[model samples]
Target: MNSRQIKLTVSYLSILLISCVSGTHYLFSVYSISIQERLNFSSVQINTIGSACNYGVFLGKPVLGYFVDNYGARRVCFAASILIFAGFSCLALTYEKIFPTSFLLCAFYLFWTGVASSGGAVSFLTTTAKNFSSNRGTAISIPLALLGLSAFIYSQINMHFFDDTFHFLLFIAFTAGLCMSFGSLFLVVIPAPQHVSDTIESGSNDSISRDDQRIEQTPLLNKNNSNTINRDQIELDIGGWQLLRNKDAISMILILVFFAGTGLMYINNVGIIIESLYHASATPHSDAKIKNLLGFHVSLISICSCIGRILIGPLSDIAKNYFDLSRICSLLFAGVWLFCGNLLALLWVHDIDQLWIVSTCIGLGFGVLYGVAPTTCSEYFGSRHFGFNWLVFKSLNLM
Candidate 1:
């Protein structure tokens, strides 16, 4: 890739990283406790808010994809960033007052955040698809890894500043505002290559020329001329539904659904698991120590998640080249890590180290899954409708 392509790639990746990290910073298990305490909410009420966010993501992805496909990525990305900024600002400002009724606040915040984040996903994937065809897998994976790093940074910030809920909200709002302002401006200039349009036109012309030559060369009296004619080549166009009907596409979508769903479940629940484990282990005498330990565990998980995101993409590229494994195998490995992480948490009774180890494992697994899944979708579906296709699969998984 040239300098421009590299710059664009880095910018998009940065935007994606910021969006994810900013949204997730306050969504971790520690925040759940803070929100509950501030608003006097029951556990059930808090869970309901989480469910709302998940369902919003499930419903919003397809709509966002369609908009991205019809319009352009720049508009969608800018708008989404604005929404994310607004959502986070709202979340930070009202989290204290919004508690049990905060379900409404959370739902609203999640709906916009979902819309914004989905746009970032589509934009980044499409940009990467446009830039590097041969190393597309690596390109996609790299951004996911960066997102992990962002998560780590955000988690640390939360851990340090989260003692005062009101102050934390202000800090999040200010940070999100800056990211949105810069991210939107940065995204506007990410030029789509002229060669993309040229290539499509050239491919279409080549198809037409080949069809004409074949028709002319064939004997008019040939019995099977019709059968020999390649309709797909002649048409030089394929619809999204036609692509979806392919067996490979169907299989790929199913795999992506499982991959995304399980990956999200882990991301959403890992902190909760750690907190609960620590809370359960600590006696009344050791409450403060256990709470501090749990905070440390959250920080470690965040840091590991960042490391995993940065490394997983490059590692997967190496694995794909060296081991000659399919992308599905990479995804399966991530899934296994998730299962093992959860199992470790379930079986290991009271050890903080065990909990931290499991959290780290889960973070690594999430990094791999997030990094590889979108790239796999692009490989199977082609880049033209990548956003729409990915959203379709992601929506299914979220549902």
Candidate 2:
């Protein structure tokens, strides 16, 4: 194919693969209650496992980034997909069998799944950054918007089909296997740029005289300058331990950890909060039915989240270029929205209508962070080392 065709094909496939991975989060949310009931665990225990899984995501990306940089994106992408498949298989088996397993195995299942899927977001972002230097913001935004579409679709399916614990686990395993298998097969390597040289000569006599004089008089000087330039160009290959030495990187990591920890906490618990409020306020007979309606409330949040992701990236880009504000401002706005969303949930949300309003607001606000943070890190650190740098930042979010 020609250059334009190649670019279009890569963009489409990358977005499709990335969206599949992002949709896993939605799947997990939908299955959370069912899994907890089947596993015979308390809400606290399930939340702890969920937190550990998020932490696993924080740890997995940087290790994958190192491999991605050394080997190639295609290898990392394929490997991650395989891991995801294996993880889901294990989850299915673990749930299906009547084994009296310890908490550690449960944590392991959650952790590995998180790790396996961690590469999905950044890998796609890196692919977009490499492919579209001019419209990187728009490219990133489009896939992210598609990822949000998963929420909309999955919410409906989850509401309708995830009626029993066994069916839910089967669905998760089947979908994960199918998506990973197809995505791995279709994953493409972006070709390196090809260069063509042009030959032109002007003032040949004068150039020859200058070259001759320089060669004779400054051989040592030229060698020294060349050595210095080479040394300057040499890059650092530090892992997470070494990266923590840099204060700026450390600070960024801390910020991401706090943001992700609280942000996910809010996202995960919103439905539960709404259900509790509805049950407490509703008539006695209506309480059980209202509790079941939590599924609808969670779905609304997912839809709002999708909307936010679709809008935030492009909006941030425009604000950065036109208003000449820092991109961090957009992230800060997202944070504010999240904080406000949680506060609203705690203070307000008495009925179903109030729940929808609050959930949508929170969903939109959370989307800002999801959409903007990865792109912001890519912008801050040069894209050449983005795999390493952004992985570090992403790991923090996992925590």
Instruction: Name the best candidate (by lDDT).
Output: 2
lDDT for each of the candidates? 0.61, 0.62
lDDT of 1 at 3: 79
Model 2 error, position 140 (Å): 1.0
lDDT of 2 at 282: 46
lDDT of each residue in 149-209, candidate 1, tens digit only: 6545655676665766666656655665566556655543354456544544564666456
**Global Cα lDDT for candidate 1:** 0.61
Model 2 worst lDDT window (10 residues): 195-204
- Name the lDDT value of residue 378 in candidate 2: 61
**TM-scores of all candidate predictions against the true structure:** 0.79, 0.79
Model 1 RMSD in angstroms: 7.6
Model 2 bad stretches (over 4 Å): 98-103, 189-255, 284-292, 351-353
Q: Model 1: which ten-residue window has the lowest total lDDT?
A: 230-239
